[model samples]
Target: MDFYELVKQRQSTRAFDTERMVDREIIARILEAGRLSPSACNAQPWHFIVVDEPDLKNKVADATSARLLGMNHFTKQAPVHIIVVEEKVNFSSGIGGLVKDKHFAFLDIGIATAHICLAAESEGLGSCILGWFKESKVKELLNIPKNKRVVLDIIIGYAAQPLREKRRKSSEEVISFNTYQ
Candidate 1:
């Protein structure tokens, strides 16, 4: 599919076929898309943890109850979960440090996650960007160090049903001509 078509087709999938498993090759392709995303000064301070184990998925679901996304329960239905983590570093002190901006790391990670989502969609997979977990609890469960922060979590698998209609605002409503209103 074309880029525009893929963008329109991609939607947040909540219900997935629990019996289906995503192939490693496809998962690798998704990860590759994320890894190739451009970063500020090429810091590349992101790490991905792909979870396919059933027990782990349950634990993640329990940790994610603080946020709601309809009837689509992530920890129970998704056969695969990719947790995106950002490795914090002092870019101001590093060599070739054009990235004096502090929030660039998070921005870069978001871009990477977008790439991953697109790639998964292109491969005929359904995914949802999950950002509702308790960060400290997630870090403890995943054994992430203090230097790294969880940026986002993505659930991927075959959708149990069809994609839902997307709700979005038009460009006319969101875009500005030259300056803020």
Candidate 2:
């Protein structure tokens, strides 16, 4: 698929085909995209934990559910979850961030994740980047160290639903020339 088309196709898929398992080759390609993504000073302060085992995936999905709000209940249907963990930034990236007054690690992780979702789209898979979840439960379930932070939980699978048109502001409304409007 063309890169622009892939970007257009990538969406936060909420409904997944529970019966269909994503191919390992496709998942590997998605991860490869993330691995090659650029980071601040080449720090690459990120680690990915792939959750595909049914029991473990269900456990991770459970952590994402909010019974009271009835939200993210669909995660259980997703066949794969990629947990992105924040690792310590490299020395130069840390220094650069401190000097520039910006959190480059977060930016780098976001970029890598974007690459992941786009790659999934290219591979004919659906994906959603979920942030609303019980971090402590996930940490315990995955045996992630206390020093590490779970940044994102990306659910991946084949979509059970068709794409909805993207709703967004027009270029004139969102973009400006030379100065803020």
Highest TM-score model number: 2
- Candidate 2, residues 1-181, lDDT tens digits: the string is 7788878878899999999998888899999999999999999999999999999999999999997899898999999999999999999999999999999999999999999998888888899999999999999999999878999999999999899899999999999999999
- Give residue 135's error in model 1 in angstroms: 2.0
Where does candidate 1 clash, by residue pair? Answer: none
> How much is the lDDT of residue 131 in candidate 2?
91
Model 1, residue 123: C-alpha shift (Å): 0.8
lDDT of each: 0.82, 0.94
Which candidate achieves the best lDDT against the true structure? 2
Candidate 2 deviant stretches above 4 angstroms: none
Model 2 TM-score, 2 decimals:
0.97
Q: Model 1, residue 72: what's the lDDT? A: 36
